[model samples]
Target: MTFVIQLMSGLAVGCIYGLVAIGFSMIYRAMGLVNFAQADIMMIGAFLGYAILVAAPGIPFWLAIIGAMLGAALLGFVIERVAIRPSVARRADQVYLVLLTLGIGIVLSNGARLIWGADPVVYPTGLTHQTLTLAGYPLPAVYLYIAVVMPALLVGLHLFFTRTWLGLALRAAADDPDTAATMGVRPALATSVSFALASAIGAAAGVLYAPISYVSFDMGVIGVKAFAAAVVGTLGSIPGAVLGGFIIGLGETFGGQLIATEYQDSIAFAIMIGILLLKPTGLLSGARR
Candidate 1:
């Protein structure tokens, strides 16, 4: 029973990681740039949800998630237009673009500290503390929420990318911008939309994760592990990112249980390193790029 509960917990955390990793992969695929600020965008989303909850305590949690997503999406769009797009327009070097994103991340983290303060904040409701008894085992309600939300979210994404014209355009733009543009798809618009979508997903991850842990400006540091997951899963592969996330999450949880809690982070990194050594293309290398 304890093992089962631990497995659920790990899966929940892995889902969060996978969400953020998807953002990383999406941006990489569309813009060919790794937005280091993606996690800070997640932190900002958590704060947005926190703000919404505080302003209207009676609002549904799903509403708060939507509010956060919209808010973060707008921020992402502005960032792309104001900073990233201009650099890309100028044909900046990849190293410079990466450093710009790193700087943007620093600005975001510090800016969040100024706005939300340096102290961590928790959700105001009892939902975070809720639990459910399942087959004689107590399960965290947040874990169940994660289980439900992750799959639904994945389904939504699948439909969006497969069924919608905008989705098809985005994929075409990412795979080949000149060809997509020749087909009447604006690559710039697709890039902007991709960033917004990625930001919204990251925000959703932040809001879902905030209940399990406190929301702090530095919480963006968790992106480090998510980045490792992206790399392990194959940086440009969406399915690979998710698989890497679960691998890291499960490895960390079991390692903490069987070895030592202090080594959990190390265990996740070790697993990532081991997997990369054996399969450099990731577990889902053959999946969508």
Candidate 2:
């Protein structure tokens, strides 16, 4: 029962990682460039939700998340249009693109620090202060909520990609921009939408995460784990990202519990290194560019 409880908690955290990783996958799929700012955008989303909740104490938690998603989406769109597009247009080197994103991430993290200060902010969890018991152990409702929510979101996304016109276009664009453009899809618009989607999804992860963890300007460091998940699961693969997230999350929790808590972060990095050494393309990369 204790093991089960810990697993549940780890899975809840994994859900957040998976959500953020999806954002990474989306942008990489569309633009073939990793957005270093992905995690910072998530941090921005968490702060946005916190701000909304603070301003209107009566607002629903879900509503606050929605607001954060919208705000992050807009931010993503603007950044793509103003910063990324210009770089692509100039035919800059891949290294330059990487540096550009890294700079954007630094600016965002510092800007957030300037606004919210460096302290961690507490976030509200709408769940009751009660725990549900199964066998001899108790589990928080937050864990159950997250488990359900994450899978549901993933399913919805899968359906959207398989069933919707825009989603198909996005997929087509990601698979091959030239072919997609020849099919009358607007590559620029699709790429912008993909960035917006990635930002919104990342922000949603932040919203979910803020409830369980402290929100801080420096919280963007968690992105390191999420990015590792993306690589381990295979960049540009949604399902792969999700699987990588669960693996990392579970490994961290189990390692902390059975080994040393102080080395929890190291556990994830080790797993990433192991996976890369074993399979450079990742567990689920399979033919994806």
Clashes of each: 0, 0
lDDT of each: 0.89, 0.87
Clashing pairs in 1: none
Residues 38-101, model 1: lDDT tens digits: 9999999999999999999978888888999999999999989999999999999989999998
Off by over 4 Å in 1: none
What is candidate 1's CA lDDT for residue 278? 94
lDDT for each residue of candidate 2 in 138-226, tens digit (9 for 90 to 100): 87655665766687778888888899999999989988899999999998987799889999989988888886778899888899999
Candidate with top TM-score is 1
lDDT of 1 at 48: 95
Q: List the residue pairs that clash in candidate 2.
A: none
TM-score of each predicted structure versus truth: 0.97, 0.94
TM-score for candidate 1, please give it: 0.97
